[model samples]
Target: MSKPKENIFDFKLFKRLFEYIKPYKLVFYSLIVLVILLAAFSAATPYLTKYAIDNSIITREEKDFLFYIVMMLGILVVSTVFQLLFIYYATWLGQNLVVDVRIKLFNHLLRFKMKYYDNSSVGVLITRAVTDMERIADIFGQGLFMIVRDLLTMAVVFGVMIYLNLKLSLIVFAMLPLLLYATRLFQKYMKKAFEEVRTEVSNLNSFVQERLTGMKILQLFTRENIEYDNFKAINERHKKGWLKTVWYNSIFFPIAELSASITIGLVAWYGGLNVVLNEGGVSQGDLVAFIMFIPMLFRPLRQIADKFNTLQMGMVAATRVFKVIDTTSQIDDHGTYIAENFEGAISFDKVYFNYVEDETVLKGISFDVEAGETIAIVGATGAGKSTIINLLSRFYEIKSGMITVDGIDIKDVTLASLRTQIAVVLQDVFLFADTIMNNITLNHPEITEAQVYQAAKDIGIHDFIMSLPNGYQYNVKERGVMLSSGQRQLISFLRAYVTNPSILVLDEATSSVDSYSEQLIQNATDKITKGRTSIVIAHRLATIQKADQIIVMDAGEIVEKGTHDELLKKENGYYKNLYEVQFLKEHVA
Candidate 1:
């Protein structure tokens, strides 16, 4: 419920946001022109009314009356045309601006380091990209430009009122201070209320998104009642935030209406008295014009406070969005090196790493894998087994030491080049809701359907895919929910195989599949890892017996390293104990 420290009216943020208008400057300048014309036409309408009354209506001149009526109708037509143009162009500009900003935000997020995602919430990010961007668009469509037009119209109306009758204009001006003070108070409280509303909106979106995503777990745990109550509390707070703004609006608008009514009453009484007594130079037309001008002048004042709030809300939203855009949590890709023909000789030399400071996950770990060698890494959970994959992929910068690929420092290679040379199949296979063929190639332009089939066939999954309802064209839906766990793993294997990367990493790839899927994975594994530089991390000991070398890790350090048979030969060795325990578990099952 605490407020953000940023000033909602900060001109620096306004200036920064205006930079997005550079591409559409032509449209923007045109919109400004239209707004000016509309304001002039609106002010002209009342003056023309006064002129028609004084010059023809009271003079019994039919010709002059008809001409003045036609003139007024013509002005109305022109004003209507300008209003339409202004509205259409303002909306077009808003949509285009938000599109540009959203694309920029998405591209920036794509480059952020894995650590950023680890600490960030997906819901908060979605709100920024979608909801906040919409608010920023309002800065152009409703906030800034609309306010400018209203103020301009007000100024033009006041000028005409003063020109016609100073005494009537003075009567209207007398009520300004009280109305201005009320608007000021409304703005002060409304700004805080708007900020709270925006914050609550973000929280509500995040809560809903997270709960829907985890609904399965919530149902499994039977915590529906508790979570629903929590949701109700958040919903109540969100409601209150909006109602606070509404309360301010309710009080301010009635006060504005009353002030306008009083100004009109005073203008009528004073101008009519002057006209009837024939003591002051107040004509019938001037009195009528003054009546019309009171509302014209006061209209903007009544609505300007609400417009300012709209502008303030936009600024608040922009602040949240720009904060994310300005984040410096991305990997530096300054390296010009491109390993076009990388040989996949990976080496981890005295590496030290920690996701959090002083909580090292890998402590001075060192290892080397020559080209075309397959290694199996085994450890108890939290023994830094998976951390190695993260470090090797350069998802996080090491606290110290170095990781090299084919004798070249990975930091000296472009991320695109480094990642292109490696393909990883994690235990949790994430398949986009797309056709199997697209998932396999990930829509890579160079990968053809025939090539995908060949890769799938090579990995022994082509037949399985063809047997599906639509074969390779079948959609897997989100996260491959449409397919069995084993089937999804096979699709994952085919995905990595089609890439033909120089290095293949299977991290817990077979940990959750059934015996039949495991057998198929074993066949695909043997075929794919043949003569390729590969690293396998698994809990199943029997599957790794043919590995070129086995590394046993304990805590953050490697405790043993050898071939499966050689490690088992050592009495009381780490690998031997792990193998025995897993072997017994499989037998019992």
Candidate 2:
């Protein structure tokens, strides 16, 4: 398949990149000056040799020859000192600039709404932050410095050659246009190859992440061989892309080397013939200087070509990183309203929502829950039960209606303020790799140890946690993988209680736990819901039998809603049928 075409390396992006080095301008400029000095010293080496050959050795002036040798040694020492200083400062500048770029990019990414994360791959985003930034740093620290030094050396040497022997210099200059043409063609082919290599790398990273995360599922299904084959395919593709890039680079270098060799041979032939024919003939010293300058002239052309390749790779990586930084958050926080204390009353008025356009998930849903009321939402999968809680939490905006808390439309209150008043315990609980205490007190860091222990005790997990090797200080591995599903759910419940929010949302929070854990959660719920408005979405009908109101949803609307007794009184009601089916299954079991 043909790959997609991207624009060539953008000079505008390079300009913006340099702006990042502005804070270290003093160091950068010092490095530039050192580079020029080093190049000048290197260019002057040929002339020094010429002076020794013509004025010292030819005239048998041994003292003059020794003086010239000592001077050359001193220049070498100065060049070495300056070169070390430039390298130190340039490396320091590159490290600091990369640090700043990562910090800025990460801060911007964190400010983006949840939807942005939902749509982007975790692996690709991580690569942009780490691998891509490293490439840019290499370009600035090493590639950029080499280009500057080599170009300056080339220019000074060419100028000196023209002054000493114009005819030989012109003969050498005739090859310049050919070198330019060759560089342009090589760059065109090499850039495309490098871009493909980057894309393939990203894909490989994504595939690895997916497999690692889903290893449990793959093992459970005994699909290890299938996954291995899939991985091998992607790995081979990445290898092929890199091989193509290397191939292009390999071909370009030898061509440049051959061109340099041809130029050197022509200079020797012409300068030697001029001396023999005595037609403004070159001196032996002048001929040697011309030959020395030939290599210096062509060397920069090779360095420039290589630097262009590094630049292209860095540019491709920067484009990906900037794309993430430039993404516009779909959810806007424009509310001017602020609520110091909420009454916990929630109302949905003709609310409609859709994840996919033109396909409604919640249609004209209307409900009112007074402060301190416990409302149970019951529905089959895809019946809009979870959608209601998602909208209430402002995780998603309602499509065409108003959801209000404390009599003010939710859209008028800042998202932070609105979420602060709510606590959610979801089915798939997410726990960071940290101590148990940190996860429980995530929202309320100031909660005392006594309060944390009390919250864990209330949820009936206190004894289990205390029995662990480190008690509340016990480490939870990634996503709480160290704990069982029931244990994780209990910790999630404790986290919600520690927050002490005014409104509580439980979405299948107790479904994954064991019977013992469920009882503990029920007890905690009773204590926590004493004065707070609570909404529960559960598959188990018995769990919600005591709710103040039960909302039975079907498709995208509330088909039936009332107290359990009232719904059971109506023979054809959805709740009545669902309850009967569950009750029969329990009895049979």
Provide the overall lDDT of each model, using Cα atoms, as 2-decimal numbers: 0.88, 0.84
Clash counts for all predictions: 0, 0
Give me the runs in candidate 1 sitting further than 4 Å from their true place: 1-8, 587-589
Q: Which stretches of model 2 miss by more than 4 angstroms?
A: 1-7, 275-280, 443-445, 448-450, 587-589
| Local distance difference test, candidate 1 | 0.88
Q: Provide TM-scores for the models.
A: 0.97, 0.94
Clashing pairs in 2: none
Q: How well does candidate 2 match the true structure in TM-score terms?
A: 0.94
Per-residue alpha-carbon lDDT of candidate 1 for residues 273-377, written as tens digits (9 for 90 to 100): 998999877888899988888888788888788788888788888889999999999998888899786787989999999999889999899999989899999
Candidate 2 achieves a global lDDT of 0.84
Q: What is candidate 2's lDDT per residue for 97-196, written digit by digit as tens?
A: 8889889899888767665777778888888899889877776777678778888888888778888877878888998778878888888887888789
Worst 10 residues of 1 by lDDT: 3-12
